[model samples]
Target: MQWTQCITSSQKRLTSASLGAITTLRLETSLIHGKTILLADLGLSSFQLTEDSSSTAFIGVDDFYVAPEFQTFRDGHVQARRASDIWSFGCIIAEVLTYMVKGSGGVKKFCDKRQFEWVPGTWWNRFHRGPTTPSPEVTTWLSELQANGEPYRVRMVGVIQKMLSLDPKERPRSAQVKKSLRGISILSLAKLVGHDLETAYKDDQCIDLLLGNKRFRSWLSAFKRTFLSTKGG
Candidate 1:
């Protein structure tokens, strides 16, 4: 679909760096070809845009998804940095991939083990120990892909590894991530499902199928009502 809003503040590389919060990232769903598909929730309230700074610029970050850089800043070890968002994105990808391969609640169970706690030394140790012993979710997902001979799964894992790098500077920028993912060719993935999708299939057409679906519109409306009522109360 239109990645315009799904992609967030990290789209622009900042001159300086700062820690910020992004607790409102959401997933919206729509029916596509008789199946429900998740889309990034890009409501006005979804993203909290802020400029970079040497200090913690915002609060209320979701601990479950907070980047290591933000954790370091919170611990008074470093200045806030936007590259933390890349880490957050990596976490999201990890969770999504886990859910896809392991089925429902996989990510919740994975996070439950960590309890969203990031002890500096312990966390750093685990971060560096990745690849050799990648997260169980990543390892399993890669295995599944390998079994199916999904050519791009390896490349996907590589990009994901970079995003989850322990050092923020080592993480790829948003554009780089986008370019890497685009190179994988969604049509190729679709081929796995026996769909003879053409490379000529426009991205907007796919977005239209998702966003313009009646089920999606209805769900969005109901979701908005529930979300607003909960907030208002």
Candidate 2:
């Protein structure tokens, strides 16, 4: 199959770059076809694509990836900001990291960890209990990633933590997230080359190293492909 076919295929899982692209580029969720619902799909007719900075008002669907604010006011219309997309991105990142470290079973356990009783005998798998507070279970899961001691995982957990902030204003913007990930990728390349991270940080020649490495270049190419293509969509 062609690369685009593979990415759009329901059978293929989203790469980390693809998840980032969805949020950063603000792509419409209708283009994605998969069992996992990454965004609230109330139907295309109910949703509007706008270019304004203000939040868009819509009725939200009952889905795990929907932001806490969306779920909190399900019975009525809710205004969703770009920060809402950041929250869903964070949840997806957490799951992706879990799968990377512990495989499919780990992803299942991660979901089970988030399931909580919101009402009498009614359970929900949400990152937050309400619009303003993150679930303790989610916090604990992030802590586990921090304690894992792997540099890439630890750095990613840091970004995910910020992305999962309860306050919409507290979440980093898409550009900030991109910068963080770029730094992490550079450090990862440094590690692969057995270069001292301190030196890598202090020197301006790190870009040269990143460009010279074939594997890093390939990864960068894939990221650009995923991000730019999704942006165009």
TM-score of each: 0.50, 0.63
> What's model 2's lDDT at 26?
20
Model 2 has an lDDT value of 0.61
Error of 1 at 225 (Å): 48
Consecutive 10-residue window with the lowest summed lDDT within model 2: 1-10
Clashes of each: 3, 0
lDDT on C-alpha atoms for all candidate structures: 0.47, 0.61
**lDDT tens digits, residues 1-233, model 2?**
12112223321132222221122212234344553334333233433444332455544445677777665665676676667766766776787778878899998998999999989999998889988777999999988977869877787898889888888888876656655566566555656654443356457557665555656556656755554354221
- Candidate 1's displacement at residue 227, Å, is 41
When summed lDDT is taken over every stretch of 10 residues in candidate 1, the lowest stretch is 23-32
Model 1: lDDT of residue 137: 44
RMSD of every candidate to native, in Å, equals 13.9, 10.1
Error of 2 at 69 (Å): 1.9
So what's the TM-score on candidate 1? 0.50
User: What is the number of residue pairs that collide in model 1?
Assistant: 3
Score residue 49 of candidate 1 by CA lDDT. Answer: 41
